[model samples]
Target: MMRRGLLAEFPTGDALIAAVRALHQEGYSRFDAFTPYPLPAVQRLLGWRRSRINYIAAFFGLSFALGAYLLQWWTAARDYPVIVGSRPAYAAPAFVPITFEMCVLGTSLSVLAALFVIIGLPRLWHPVFAIPGFERATIDRFFLGVDESDPYLDRDRTTRALLDLGALRVSLLGEEAPPP
Candidate 1:
C-alpha cells in the first residue's frame, strides 16, 4: 500500500519552520515536523497547544487525596472507632501525611497514564520510519511531513512549494505493513 503523505527534508530547522508556516498559512493543518531537537518556533507556528497532562495530574491528585482523607476518617471514626494518645478518632491533622502521599502517588500514576495515552505509546513503527534517511530526524536533520488527507494538499503544488521553500529533498512515503 502507498502512504498518502509527503515528507520533505530541509537543510536546517529554519527552512522547515518556514515551510510549516507557509503550509499553515495556506490552510494546511494536517502536517507534522520532526527535528534533531525541539523547536519552540516550529511548535508555535504549528499552533500546537500546551498539553493537558498537568490538569489530569491535578484532578487525580486532588481526588485521591480527598478519598484518602475520607477513608481514613471513616475507618478511624465511623467504621471502627479508634482512640490513640487521647486524640480524636477522626483527627484531620493526622491524616495529612497519608493524604499527601496518596496525592503524590495519584499524580504520578495519572501522569504516566496520560502520557502513554497522549503519545499513543507502544507504537513501534510509523510509515515515516520506512523513508530512507529519516533516521537523521534524531541526529541532525529537520523534516516536514504533510498528510495527504489535508484539505489543502495538492500533491503537485505542495511538492513544488516544498522545493521552493529550500527543501533539500522531497519524498512520497510508502506505507509499511504493521507488525503482526
Candidate 2:
C-alpha cells in the first residue's frame, strides 16, 4: 500500500531548516527535507552525520592487506620455500605490490557494496514523488516531509505543525486530502 505523509513547502532553505529544527525539538524525528542545493544546516537539523561507508572501506582494506601479506609470507617462507637470486624466502618487499592491490580491491568493492545496501538503491520510484509540486523540489523549492510511519504523525496535527512553522503550503502526500 502506498504510504501517506505530510509535506510542507518552504520558500527558502533556511526556512526549511528552521521548520525542521522546530519540529525536531517538538519530538518529531521521522522527517526529511529536500532543497534545490546542498544545505548543511538542514542536514544538521535532520541529525544526519558522516557516512559509515568510510569506516567500512577502511576496515576491509586494512584487513585484506594484512591477510594478503600473511598469505604471501606463509606460502614463501613455510609452505614451499623458493630461493630466487639467493634472496630470503620470506621476502616482505616482494609482497608490497600485491598487498597494495588487494587493499585497493577490497576498499573499492566493499564501499560499492555498502553504498548499495545503505542507500537502498535499485528502486526506480518513491512515494514522495506523489507530493503536489514536489517536482520543483530539485529546481527552486525546499520541502519538509513527515512520514506516515512516524509514531507521532497525525494528519491534522502535522498540517497544523507545518502551517504554524510558516509553511507556504501543506499538502497530504500519497493520499488525497479528506473533504472539509
lDDT of each: 0.87, 0.84
- Top model number, lDDT: 1
Task: State, as a TM-score between 0 and 1, how close model 2 is to the true structure.
Answer: 0.66
- Give the local distance difference test score of model 1: 0.87
The estimated TM-scores of all candidates read 0.74, 0.66
**Model 1 clash pairs?**
none
Candidate 1 lDDT at 79 equals: 97
Kindly report which residue stretches of model 1 are placed more than 4 angstroms away from their true locations once superposed: 1-3, 25-29, 36-38, 81-88, 151-157
Q: What overall lDDT, based on C-alpha atoms, would model 2 receive against the true structure?
A: 0.84
Per-residue lDDT of model 1, residues 21-133, tens digit only: 88788888987888899999988876789887899999999999999999998999889989999998888899999999999999999999899888889777778877889
Q: For candidate 1, what is the TM-score?
A: 0.74
Error (Å) of candidate 2 at residue 91 is: 3.1
* Model 2 Cα lDDT, one tens digit per residue, 132-174: 6788989999988888888888889889989988899998777
